[model samples]
Target: MKINFKNYIASIFITVLMVSIFSSCTETKEEVTLLFVGSFTDKKTGEGIHVYEFDTETGKSTLKHTIDSITNTSFQRLSPNGEYLYSVVDSQKKYNGKVAAFKVDVPNKKIDLLNIQDCGGLNPAHLAIDSSGNYLVNSNYSDGSLSLFKINNDGSLSENSQVLQFKDSSIIKSRQRASHMHSANFSPDNNYVFAHDLGADKIRGFELVKKQGKVSLENPKEIKTKPGSGPRHFAFHPNGRFGYLVNELSGKIDAYTYSNGNLGFIEDYLTYQQKQHIYRTADIHISPDGKFLYASNRGPEEDTIVIFSVDENSGKLQLVGHQSTYGEHPRNFGIDPSGNFLLVANMYTNTIVVFKRDIVSGKLTKLPFDISVKNPSSIQMKTY
Candidate 1:
């Protein structure tokens, strides 16, 4: 058939218009939504967990849902695909040691209870999922044990995949006398798991030996800190070039040179606390861009957030300065996934304070607004 030139041009334009419209529809995927999981059941009322919705762009939030799946759910993290969320229910039910997984239907704002797995450690304080979402690591503060669970494709966790026990004694005999696994983190390659044992005063490393989807421990070793240096939380650089582990007891952040999932001592430790001070530090987080680091000092002498500049060349942290949290006992704080805002969980004050980030300067300015929570221990952000 003979085609007219004018019609040919019109047809091409029409096709281009349709393609642009389809692309416009694809823009919906750009907006990232966040989930804030904080259990409101404190020493008083048992109101279950409060999951809130957060907007990265507008810095706005709304109450999403309250889940009563477990008692005292504290820490939460999403799978790589953002499909499921795993939480640690820090229970005082006498060795209850429970962890729960929830299947999230993001767009619909829905969650289905998946299953609960025994943490294998007492009072699982913090939980972290490997990059591949294959293993979930828990830090049992009371039990002083590290438990790792493999996540099946069905969102159900595998049966007690592995557990590593720690041994030691420190200043707090009754509290930190034995083993207190404060935090568990995985290397980017997911080949090694590093756990901070507060009571042990050491950072323990283990090889996540994988066989047929079951994980076994290999090459277990401990990096000793100063006596009574209660190692707490740590963060990995974005480029996977370096790792920073923070010691809450000693108030120091140790930088390391990590390679192929193995960490080499940079042989340098950066102190974030003042002399002769004890504040029971909480959480540490690296910026999304991995250019900076932030560590929180929990209580006692002036609650503040210590900021540091990350040297990309050496993976060492240079102290930036401390910012007044404007609240009490900042146990947990989170840098938004977008690297724009920071929200601190002031435990005793029952407030979540906000800060505006200076992307250029890498400093935080206090914002007037804050949210109230019963006892927010740790904070995490997940977007879909």
Candidate 2:
């Protein structure tokens, strides 16, 4: 019959304004960071590396991709430029354990396999890339050796540049029967490499020498830990003067003053106050901002993350608090690039739990959401 022309005009104007506002908001939204989770694959359990899109603002994660061909990608490291990712395949078969390189395609959220090289030892567990991105180092647990690889210009790995095996064993009869190198990392200056040997109870240092574009290890030095300590992982503070060595057997953290790649002992801090239960310490990490340190431990009945506040001036750690992982056997954990969230990969429970971090207090509060993956051993993040 009759139409109200004024009302119709007002409705059209409101729709146009709302669309413009929505478009502007969408255009200004921040991009999501990509998180890559490595896991142990098997015949009975689902396996592969999982890619997740993480929202920094809301601390939410969504699975984006999965790569299943490689088994036992238990540990991974990203190149400094974020253009390539390297992972160690932990296996017991002789010379079967390998290190693999993958070219990262960030825009499409895919990784192209570049090359896989034998790690020159058995059961390669951890790997690290040098600051120049020219060399890769790996620690072999079963054979107690360290292997070095040169990086080609295109990010593929060259043949093993060097491999050094250890013969010494500590006093522990069962766990330290032979030297087992658990973790390897480059010094802040990239002039030295530190390999933490669990069975030897020592953090061994080797000079990284480059001559005429070829790299070699020399001038071996050893930093002894407590008897049967079983140092598993190492982390350097952002200040480059302090180093943290987490002992897997004793459940203790050793603070060291690092100068010119030499580590001088500072003090020992216990991860757990109560000593009644057996402690199985797993991983250690420092926050990006260098304000806090976190260590994961899997006890007989409980899995927890211990937090500590870093004293910037003195390079000392003060116990802050602890948070239960709500899962079993937290093998590894990672801090987001922003240091706002922490993700723990509980191996036995097969879950990755997210926790919101309180930067000011150096505390972790569990988030409601948890990611389910089979035998998740490591969690690493890369920002887009």
Model 1, span 109-169: residue lDDT tens: 6577889888887777788888887778888887678777878888888777777776778
Candidate 2: tens digits of C-alpha lDDT, residues 1-384: 798999999999999999999998879645558888988886222356788888887778898788867678888899988888888874544554889899988878878889999899988889889888989999899989999999999999998989999998998788899999999889998899999999999999999998998889999999899998999999999889999999988999999988997898989898875683567888999999999999998877658999999998888899998899989999999999999999999889888999999999989998887899988988889787
lDDT of 1 at 194: 86
- The TM-score that candidate 2 achieves is 0.91
The most accurate candidate by TM-score is 2
| Top candidate, metric lDDT | 2
- Measured against the true structure, the TM-scores of the candidates, in listed sequence, are 0.89, 0.91
Lowest lDDT sum, 10 consecutive residues, model 1, at 40-49
